[model samples]
Target: MASGFCEDCSRLLDEFCVYLRKVCREFEQKIRDVFRELSQCTCFRIAPESSFLRRRRRRRTQELLSLHLLCDDETQLLNQESLHALSRLASSEDTDLQTTAAMFYLHVSHHLKSSLPDAFMEPVMALLLSTDLDVQKTISLSLVNLLAKNNVCKELVIEMGMLVPILELFQSGDAAAQCHSCACVTLLASSESKSEAIMVDGIMPLLALAKSYEPQVQQNATWALLHLTQSDWSTRILCEVGAIPVLVLLLQSSDSQVQFYSCTALCNIAAVREHHPKLLSMGGHFLLKSLLTLVSSSVQKNSTQACRCLQTLSRNVLIQEQLMELDCLVPLKALLKNSSPVRRESAITLLSALSAHPPNNDVLVSEGLLEEIGQLLHHQTSVIITHSCKIITDLCGSSMGQQAVMDSLCVSGLLGALLSPSVSDETSLHVTSCLYHLVTWDPLKSNLSVTITSEQVSRLVRLSGLIQNPQLSYNSAAIISTLAMTEEMAQLLRPHYITMLEYLLVFLKKKDVKLQQLGILTVFNLKKDGGFSSLLAGSELEAQLWKVHAQTEETRRLLQMITPLSPSPVDP
Candidate 1:
């Protein structure tokens, strides 16, 4: 009956006084129903609320009505009734009713959340500032729920100039208030324009809380720092403000989650290419050692995160060398055999970084790592095989790693993988990329087939046409271009080249200026062989040839589109 009453109360809010006397009598039955239902709802079980949930649903009805009144064009007519009801309810000493009253007032005073709708700003701020801790928490949480609407909270916080008070809550408010305030600040800083302002105005306050004994404050503050550091210069500011040492300290916290977020924040900031050394100088290696050690004993979730931090730290050139000196490669290599393909891929990616320089390559090859990577290609998983192919690609692209790869049969297997129609685009890209490196480095042209089979030429030609997609086009063209440059290779490509030119001539007549330019460049390189001249010699070629044929310079004559009946290049 009381649940029905609250529903009716919203529809008949003007009669709230008549219903007020019966609220207790009717609310009892409804309250029981609510708790009975609440026993099943996740929120009530997760953070069970008996008295709070019972009252909230009713109060929410009133608050929604007040909010509607605030936007009503009929506000003048309802103003007197609404204010009298709110004023009476606000003066009530009962905590739950007062909490409800606070929510109701803040709802109507929507100016608290938005700087743009300056409609009720001063009044709402005064009401909120005057509320006691319990009421303040209720109102803040209620206001914050609106934040879930997307950039709503962020825009308002910026307009209200409330970062300071919100940050003050981080130091002094209840956990609920602090969490919401941190969340609000997070929403605000998410805006690129607002981030710098928060950093300048809010960082000091956030830093104080980041060091607080409270884990919640520390977690949110670390997140805030992470968000701020996404900007170009936020790193120097964060480091100067002692964020590095604090993060390192947080990494040592007894709380695993705190350590996780702090490590993540540190990794994000450290990943910036130049700021890397500073992160390392400030005990980054010690943190990485700690993270790597966790890989052996920690839960799989935590171990994965620690491994990721290790990978992020490994991206630094100087830090990677230091890791090698510490002989960390054994543990990282050991992870390649982990049951998780993700773990193995991460290990491969980290190991690939060893090829970044000659010294690192020396360290890696001395371990006979190429053979292990080649073994991964034989593993059943495509992901593993793809990553292994990538590692082989990176290694062979360098001068030092070629001989081990060629001897491993890596090239043939990878080529077969590329030709498989079922291979994903990503795998194909990696395989072709590896092929490019392997073929270009093959000193004897041993990798190049003496007779490029018709099937291979047709596939290359089809793949070459995909260049029109722009991304794949240039890369596909370069691959075809490379394959065509070999001596016997040119003869095998002759049929495909003829087909490509036929399409190229048609594309040239199109009005797309960029496409025309790309088409011309494509044929320009092919015509250098003078094989294109014989193909274009017939009267068939004369019909579509350009009118400005003879005007082209002597050196470019073969590439210049022909004028019909112009003297064909009969001799050199």
Candidate 2:
């Protein structure tokens, strides 16, 4: 009885194994049949009969629902049996089945903590080469989802040689397909190692699509190009491939997103100085106009970037002239008052560039830029103060600019910055230089006594003692010389005269030709007031001047006019 029971149990176990295998096979066959039927039924081309159309629509919906339900079961979804069935569907001749299968694969892959098996990459990439527009679109999107944030999957796709085919879609695919393809390329490019491969395979095709009439296509293509431009070599290649004209034209796009990306690409290109001439020759004026408009309107996202582009373009002298001709300072002055510090900095920077050329200085003054820059002196940020000071300093090279700066009454702000311990040495130099121009403006000589104060004079004298900053020291000495032209002003500076003359002697003894000349000029002006002249004669500065007067032609020429009353040398 025991042997008989054992035989029956063994037989039953075999039968159960056979039953399970048969069930799995039957289930898979049913899934294939449904997929085949769905692929064969073209809902778009269905018969016009109301009843027939309704039935077909219901059937398609039910089939899709059943597939979704199957996918919803996580336990069965990752099973080897389900994966095999899905792979077959992904490669099916029916486009609908291929799309659904690709999407489901992506969904499953996304949920898994570990990467999908490398074996699965082939069928997914195979589907990407599908001639069916719907299949290509779905597969491209699924690939993007599958490969996102997953370096292993990206490598697998590249290893399978899918990059070129994927890029090819951007050339011939419909708008949606092109957009999706561009997105995939962008994702792949995010991997620093993979960017070169994408560039090698897709750059030209991407450039072509940047000109597409579809705003979406234009945006995606330019975004991809923007990524490519991050590298120095890629930026050069982009310009070489004629991306500048295409990107510039896209600036006029009605879609702000398109405009933003295109502007970004052009901005990157503009950063490479070698590309500037070509960019300008290729209607960079339009680009300049577009950036100016964006900057003027103060579109927050693009405004700073636009300002940067303008700043870069402003390096070109011809471009500077053109920008002035276009009346760029009106918007730039408005930007200086903008609440955004970044916009303010960029605006000031562009203005500084424009102001570098002597001709633009008069325009800047005429446009009320001096007063606008003066307003920024109250800002708490150091860069704003520094750039504002720099613009004023550069503009002050001209008489009109100096008069404008004086007329605007910006000297007090500059004096404050010069005295502020928190200000950078560079900013101090700029402020001091600007003040030098203001105080030395011969036309404003009559107003010097009223325009400058005793406190400001004290600060100037102290600044002259800063041995580390020879330029600041020289500028400070020069301002004192101008103020000392009047007896009252000279008396106001008398308390600090000893320290001032000591610092001036240090500058006089320097090897730098400019500093020596400044020192001589300060002494010459100080002698204009008899009391200051007599004090200078008794001080040790007289010996230092005689010692330096023989060093260089500039010093000798400048000192020939100053006749110190005392001939005796002071003890060292």
Candidate 3:
């Protein structure tokens, strides 16, 4: 059966080119027949209104049946010619016939959702150079749908050969051709090697077309540039082509789409860390405000791309300063309220960048950004909670931001997250670092025990005792010392004195003397309270352990300070 089938296919292959031309002519004839029928129906309705309703549904059915029959005929032709025959006919030397064949197949592919051969990609790509405006329009319009719908086609075209031929479409004078060809190269450039091929040679054309008089061509070209500007080499080549200024100017396009494309493209280039100097030299920082516009966009992808762009841009110290100069801190913080996870994630990441910069904290603290970030502490997504913890921890780098975070986040946010039963080890570390910084900076100035419950206090003391997580344990151990500065603060930790002391002893027993100093100090603060100290007042084991670890000057000073009833430890 296979041999017979191959033999018949070989016979059909000999005449498939003629068969394709016939199919094209028949398809065009069917279209003209429809126009003739529509003309007749219009005259019939004008001359006699009685026949309008009678003929309308019948004509519509016949038109659909005719199109369906053409599709059935094409499917039969595909079966007869076999897939291999498509390659021969698609590469035919007769350009006009090839164009018509492309038209017929494009129409058939549209009408029938599947079973269209991908072997025709080369013909459509080659037709890109046709000087005929109508041919260019036909191929450009058809190419976008074919490429968009088929991943198999994308893979096939990626292997076909050099993308240098596609460059002509970028410079093609016709607007529709220019618009769709821009779209074509955009889709084609999604392939990594092909992207390099296009970026290396076609970057100039893509950039020039990005400034087109036509909005669609500009949008399409900008979208193409976004795909091509991904790799380090492409980004460098794109910078060499002066895309930064065009992108900065295109950010203000009246068309929102063009603006978004330019934002994504420019951001992709800016994501390369080494390219930062080039971007700034070309005045690319001017794109930040427009990028902010996209961050606030109602479209999720636009918002996501914009937030990510700013996230990378903010990494540069100069751009971080530029972001503050543009007054971007408040608007950036507004994205925390967004419902989309992706957009919020990117926004949170950007805030993490801003929050770490000391100068950004001036604006952030003034804008009350801490309060907004503090609210997401118990968010259902653990990653957001983790990143939020990081943001607050970074914000704690400065005294003013630290105070603002403590004022807004201490009771309402970080403590609650730290006290949660399911909080991960990583999140616990950052959250405790925030508390550690808060108390270390202005322990006595701010009252942490105001609204905090005994349970939350117990959780912190217990976290300090954790043996498995040393960093969290040590930071929590350090936090317990300053948190005990006030009588009321010491009183809150009074209930968990046993757990608190266990961790502090764990700190003292270790070889690291700084931790020993911190441990003894924390014990001194907790031991000074009568109620807290009285729990271990009669316990000689505590004193003996202290004596054993007091070999260092710091530990002895701590011991002496607490001498008359053991009242204090050495403080930093």
Q: Which prediction has the highest lDDT against the true structure?
A: 2
- Model 2, 438-526: lDDT tens digits are 66566654455567777878877887888887777777777766664666776787787677778777887778878778888877877
Q: Please give each candidate's TM-score.
A: 0.59, 0.60, 0.61
**Tens digit of lDDT per residue, candidate 3, span 1-572?**
35555767878876897899999999999999987787678555644346785695465455344434555665553443333333443455655544554565567546555644655455556665555656666766676776677523654554554244455666556666666666666676564454454355556777777888887667778877776676465566677778888887887788878777778887888778887776677454557767877677777777777888888887888888888888776666667777666766778888887878776776777788778777766563656777777777667667776677667754457778876777787878877776665665554225554656677777777777787887888887676676534676766776676666566666767777677777767667666778766776656437745565556657668867875764348752
Give the least accurate 10-residue stretch of model 3, judged by summed lDDT.
80-89
- Top candidate (TM-score): 3
RMSD of 2: 14.1
Count clashing residue pairs per candidate. 1, 0, 2
Candidates' C-alpha lDDT: 0.61, 0.73, 0.67
Collision count of model 1: 1
Q: Summing lDDT over every window of 10 consecutive residues in candidate 1, give the lowest-scoring window.
A: 114-123
Which residue pairs show collisions in model 1? Answer: 467-473
Flag regions of model 1 displaced more than 4 Å: 1-98, 105-134, 142-178, 188-237, 271-278, 291-316, 352-354, 378-390, 397-400, 419-427, 443-572
lDDT by residue for model 1 over 1-572, one digit each (tens)? 35555666667875776688689778998999988888878876556556887796677577547645655553342355555555545555555556656666445435333332333333334434544676766655655654545414455556666666666666554677777676666555555454565556666777777787877778777777666665555566677666777777777777777777777777777677676656666554675676666555354555566666667777666777787777777777777777776677766766665665556776676576777776666553566656666667656655557777756656555655656666766566666666656656645135545333556556656665664454344444445555545556667667676677765665456555554555566666566666866676663433444532333345376556554546659852
As a whole number from 0 to 100, the lDDT of residue 477 in candidate 1 is: 47
